[model samples]
Target: MSAAPSLPVRALAALGRPVIAAARATLELWGVLIGTLAGIIRSYGKGGRRPRGAVVAQMYAIGNRSLVFVAVTLGFIGMVMMYQACLQFSRAIGDLSQVGLQFLRLVVSDFGPTLTAMMLATRVGAGIAAEIGSMKVTEQLDALRMSGVLPIDYLLVPRFLASIVMTVALTILGAAIMYGAGGLTAWLSFGVNPRTFFDPAMVQPRHLALGLVKAVTYGAAIPIVSGFCGLRARGSSEGVGWATTAAVVGSSFAVIALDFALSVGALWLFGGDL
Candidate 1:
């Protein structure tokens, strides 16, 4: 009886921390969004020089540096998706066409793009938070502000744009690879023609549109979460680490929740067509 009570207490304490942390994170994210928007308006009102160079640099950093990791991760995802899908298809159906359709539905509709975004959020989003948090701790951001540089436009906007580009590109690439791998596996196991794998008709335009919407949504959400978490850091190394973790976790939850919402919205909009 005592053990049970103690376990509940500990669990509640653990749960409470995340709840408070989430609330704080939410406040910080709103602050960053408001501040960034205000800064944008101010820049436009005063005809302030846009930080075009910095934006370009940030785009390159976020999009380019992330490519190798995204490719490798996607490759493995493709391989595994092929193997598992083949096993499942083998159990129920003897037709390779059926397997191909199943693969298309799974990859195009949800798994490929959603999983890719989650992985990117975990990998690059955390890094962005830590980097910003470290810079804040060192007063580098303050120094930039003192020098008349708007950090949001210079740093955050580029990341925001880059995330969308990266998410879309990576997901498409992953889906292609997964389809190819699954096709190959199906050919070997069930003697399906490999060419039957990537029928243009199977490439649903609606799924692609859904993926684009999701990528852009995630792109916007990640930078906001990361930038906010960094801004809220308590100016210490430990704080930086904590902020990084918060950014990843918060952004991940945001991605998943948004995916579900988008799925529902997409269905409502296009379910009749499908």
Candidate 2:
């Protein structure tokens, strides 16, 4: 066997300590999320009834409360997308219908799902983390455990289920808002008729399915990352701040990365049908 490392080697090893710790923490977080998922699934099958009120409250919190912001943001996105598409198409065909068709594909398949997810990650993910982290720092999590409540089952599951459902719902809602706003923008800004700005045929079922896939994955990622960071938090207010920040950052990165992967995969499989 080789001898032990020298002092220099040990000193150099410290350089990698942070990286290794981060990697380990990431892996541990994923493990916790996986366990949480399994717990939710197990609870759903033969498990006792979950708190329906909690789930409903979560849905309302995650879904209904987010509509105004989603609407305004997506509406602006739609207008911008329409303006750009019109500018490009006007130089070529000058056909509003064609412009509308292309816009629909680009927005519904990619931007709609991706941007909405990022927005949700920024807002909802941070909120989840802050709340959970505060609870953690306050010893509320331990109290729940002492009270015979499975925290994962009682807390994470409802959030997960609600997030998945709401993100999917919001994707569809945002798409509609975007399309409508784009159509109007096209008409007002580009002389394209409103009637010609929206073509139902442009939105294929494949696009719908792809959007849903993005929504679900992004949705799951946000709450999982956020809740995990929050639950693991220590210290005091600073810890909660760090957890919230981490949730937003991690969820944002996950959304973008997942969007790219899904886009590439779908393109490979469907040859742009997606």
Candidate 3:
């Protein structure tokens, strides 16, 4: 028989188990994300088949369904931003119009994309995970394969594209509503005219483009992360539920992490003065 481990060895082994498991999980997740991206690229290739209906449907679900939710949440976020910043900007600049200038810069540069992605992670990411996890647990994925339907193409590709397109569009819409809300809040609460609270010139093209880039990056990532968790789910309904939770948590973390990275990159690449 092998010699029993010493206390130090036992402790190290115990620590190693969790660390190894987390490393494996992370590697598997990266593989899944890369494979999903490859599948999308293949579908766009001449040798591959593209699925249009699935893409459209997912766009409707991720984009159209999210409109009201994004609108309401972002609208309030803008008002809150105005309430906090109006006093500071007005007092400093002695011009409430400066509030609008500052608001646009802050919202477009950071808050707009980050908040939208986080909200979507909880809602759309969770739903995608649960739905696909249930299918995985039920052997539906195998059935699709048996029927000659590639799950990556029919399921993941559509979601990937839809999320990017819809997220970008929805982010624009939400930002519009948020600006309106900020203006209204500034006018009524701070006695700043709504018109003066808006100056399109204060926002640079880079700011707007970077915001969309962030949104698109997050949009594409959520599906890959959620679908990875879902496709790997096993065991009972409890397992599926856990997978759903994992998807949301993982996607949310990714959204925040990516936002930070992208924000820094944007600043470095474009040199955002604001």
Of 1 and 3, which scores higher on lDDT? Answer: 3
Q: How close to the true structure is residue 102 of candidate 2, measured as C-alpha lDDT?
A: 74
Computed on alpha carbons, the lDDT of every model, listed in order, comes to 0.76, 0.86, 0.86
Ranking by TM-score: 3, 2, 1
Per-residue C-alpha lDDT of model 1 across residues 208-263, encoded as one tens digit per residue: 77877887787778888888887777859999999899889988998899999999
Off by over 4 Å in 3: 88-95, 272-274
Give the residue spans of candidate 1 off by over 4 A: 1-24, 37-46, 272-274
* Worst 10 contiguous positions by lDDT, candidate 2: 42-51
Which of 1 and 2 is ahead in lDDT?
2
- Deviation in Å, model 1, residue 115 alpha carbon: 2.3
Error of 3 at 37 (Å): 1.8
Let me know the TM-score candidate 2 reaches against the reference structure: 0.92
TM-score of 3: 0.94
Candidate 2 lDDT over 1-274, as tens digits, reads 9999999989889878988999998898888688778767767667567567888899899989998888899999888878888888888876666877877887788888888888899889999999999999999988999998877877788888899999989988888899899999888888887677677677888887888888898888888888988887889999999999998998899899899999998899889455
**Candidate 1, residue 214: lDDT:** 80
Top candidate when judged by TM-score against the true structure: 3
